[model samples]
Target: MKIAILGDSLVAISTAHSLLDQETDAEVHLFTERPEIGLMNEGPGIFEKWPPCPNHWISDLKSQEPSEGSNSVRRSWFEKAIAIALSERGCIIHLRTRCTDVSSVHVEVKGAGRIGSGRIPFDIVSDMRSVSETSTEWSGGVCITGGEPKLEITGNRSDGTTELWWSGPRKDTGSWLQEMKWIGEDPRESLTSEIKVGIEIARTLVDTIIQKSPGHKIE
Candidate 1:
């Protein structure tokens, strides 16, 4: 099966891995405008999580040397590393490519100058772009601004350690409404937990799709 996954978020990456795992012969392509994986202007604290797999992508992330001084530089390094890992895993990644249109069987994309535009036929086209329309209410003082609202919550755990989490929508572009980030001691464990959540969400979505079409092969 030929599958084209849109976006470069963690969910999109996880879905691509899941689809490839199910069918090794399946051709999977990722379309994104950014050269690196994940959001280009994502915050430093926010990290990309990966679903459980035979080759743990996080291991590559953890093994990287702390050569970069700035957090943004480090994040870019990690994102590039992830892109490499995905490529190694049999995913054809099209960097600097944007999906102009997507239908049931084909995805129209435009690349950089000289690369031009092209259409790729696929058995299934999954839109993994994140959309945020859900409104969250917190107990603290909430302030509405012209741009995206920022909400940060900090609580003390039973062990006396402090836990911090924040969520807000992307004000720049894309369908992503809001994104959440949690501070954890271990990046690997935190990422693993997040990936598990992503996988469950993906499963639910697949289940719904399968329910509609009982004969579809998704697993």
Candidate 2:
């Protein structure tokens, strides 16, 4: 079974991390736009590059100005959240994760341009459940291992699409929710719930895999 996931750094990393944790015999690959920084591990070789290329660009970026500051940190978190959202969509097309008869998947990430590409052969592909975003009404902050994420919710006139926006030195300003809509209830609340649902669905899938795999530790 071969699966391909093409998306942002967060989604790529999370998928890779989760699958790696599973430790299944199946082969897994991670795809991301920022693969240079995403896959580049400079462990123990930071001194070799000296001032130019140091180890842990993600860590270093987090410690700097906008990423390190209070408000900006929240912005950073949301930005990453948006990236992961893309992966949520990509996983579904990979394979029929809902059933056991299906095996292997090919996931692909499509956006402004291709940042990275890879393949993950597996017994099943995870499905994307939901997506969430914080609005001015949520009134809170998020803490991340690297930095916090910023969120901005906007209402669109065309289709009344509510989008989360964020900008910073190292952050990208864009709608994290992607194609999702904000119609009936409060946009922020709706998005937040959606994200929770998505996470829950992923969790359920993991449980199902574990139950069937028995001895295999599926992350």
Best by TM-score: 1
Residue 82 error, candidate 1, Å: 3.1
**Candidate 2 structure quality by residue, lDDT tens digits, 31-107:** 33342322231101001111211122123333322321122222233334333433443323222111212223544
Candidate 1: which stretches are off by over 4 Å?
43-55, 62-79, 113-115, 136-194, 197-219
lDDT of each: 0.53, 0.32
- Candidate 1 residue-wise lDDT, 100-218, digit = tens: 88897898889972446988787777777765334442221112122223334432222222223343432332322333343334332333444454466556545544555647776
Candidate No. with top lDDT = 1
Alpha-carbon RMSD, each predicted model: 10.3, 14.1
In terms of lDDT, the poorest run of 10 residues in model 1 is: 137-146
Those runs of model 2 whose alpha carbons end farther than 4 Å from true positions after fitting are 1-6, 9-28, 32-60, 63-69, 74-120, 127-199, 214-219
For candidate 2, report its TM-score.
0.32
